[model samples]
Target: MKVVIVGGGKTMFFLGRNFAAKGYRVVIINRNMEECEDLAKQLKAVVIFGDGSNAGTLEDAGTASADAVLAITPHDQDNLVICQLAVNRFRVPRAIALANDPDNVKVFEKLGIQAFSTTHIVSSLIEQRATFEEITNLMPLGEGKVNITELVIGSGSPVAGKQLKDICLPDNSLIAVIIRNNQSIVPRGPNELHLNDRVVVITLPENHGKVLKMLTGEE
Candidate 1:
């Protein structure tokens, strides 16, 4: 897989490093020369110094061949334009944008771009922390319409030792993967949930609480 990351700073550096570690071809585009130099040295990626919102810049970054494009620039307008160009111009399979303002998330989604708002995610996490202790690594997708969450099964969990087919999950919710003792298992009809198993679930935001309650027995 090839990933093109737009913008700079810690997020770009870490994202580039993670993709490179996964053996994906990583390309980074940044407007700042110093940051580009730093990232080129720190990450095993092709670093291009230029404004990512520009078509020529994206072309230079090889966006045409990128499997995915991530636009995480500080400015929301720039991020939106970068994503649009990546999708409509380069025909990239996946394009994600960071919406600096929470209100822009829906707007980005309306324009056919996947977006997430850091402000919204942080606030949601704070609220969830007060009520749900068992849920972790909660990620909002589809502009907060969908969510991906992780929960661990304990001895007292309602779904513990139950086969996936037998668990009554909420509508639009699915246990995508179960992590047991450092191994990942794709959930099947006969796959049984075990104690200490970490399950990754995908569900609509409205069904999140219900799914958690069903799996962890927590209200």
Candidate 2:
């Protein structure tokens, strides 16, 4: 996969390195020459010095064939423009933007751009930790109609030691993956739910509560 990242800060640095390390062709487009030079030296990906929001700069950065484009600049407007150009003009398959202000997420969403806000994500993490002990992660998808959630199996849970096929998951939900002892497994019907294992599931919004109850056996 080819990924084009627009920005020069910490987000770009980490994402460039991680994606490059994963063998994906990565490219970074930044406005600052010094930051671009620094990133070029530090990361294995290509670093281009230009304004990412500019269509010509993106064209020079090879955004036309990019599998995904991430507009992660601190300025929300710049990110929006970059993502819009990538998705609408360049026809990139995935266009993601970073919302520096949590309040900008709605605008990005309204514009049909995938937005990731660190501030909102961190706040959600803290809130989820406080409110739901069983749910470790909650990613809402399709305008919150569906969710991808992670549930940690407890020792006293009724589903523990039971085969996945034997457990009746809520409608429109299924176990997608299992993380056991740091190993990720594509769960199968014969797989058994073990204590301390983290189970990731794709479930509908209305069924989310039921999924939690079914797994943890707690209200």
Candidate 3:
């Protein structure tokens, strides 16, 4: 995957490193030349020193073929514009924006942009900790309509003893992968779920609740 990050803050700095370590093609854009140089040296990622909200800067960063574009600048308006440029002009498959102001989350969502605010995430974590404890990761996909989540299977989970063919998953939900005992299993109709299995799934956001209920036996 090719990822373009529009920011020089700690978020993008660590994100660039992690993505690069995972073998993704990473690019970093920042308005500060010194910061760009430092990031390039530290991450070994392609760095462009310029305003990411500018179409020309994004073009130079190869946004045309980017698999995912992240707009995490400090300014909410700049983040929105960068995301809009990535989705509307460059046709990037995924555009993610960071909403500094909690109130702008709805505005960004209304415009078909996937936005995340730190305040909301931290608060949600506190509220949903028990319910989502098994979730290793959760990311919005397809502009927030769908979510991809990674979950670890426990011994008493509802799907632990069933085969994929026998389990009735929610509509639009698909198990993308199963990692069991250090082995990655491509899920098939006859594949049996086992305890300690790490599963990755994709599903519509509305169906996420049903999926959790089915997997964890919680209402």
TM-scores for all candidates: the values are: 0.73, 0.71, 0.63
Candidate 3 TM-score versus the reference = 0.63
Reference-based TM-score, model 1: 0.73
The global C-alpha lDDT for each of the candidates, from Candidate 1 onward, is: 0.90, 0.88, 0.87
For residues 92-152, write the lDDT of model 2, one tens digit per residue. 9999899999888888999899887888667655654565678878887774567798989
Best by lDDT: 1
Regions of candidate 1 where Cα sits further than 4 Å from its true position: 135-169, 173-203, 214-219
1-219 per-residue lDDT for model 3 (tens digits): 999999977878999999999999998999998998888788969999999999999999999999999999999999999999999999999999999998999999999998988887676445444576788888765545677888888766889978999989977899999998888988899999888789998877668778866776655
lDDT of 3 at 3: 96
Residue clash pairs of candidate 1: none
Candidate RMSDs in Å, in order, are 4.3, 4.6, 5.2
At residue 174, give the lDDT of candidate 1. Answer: 94
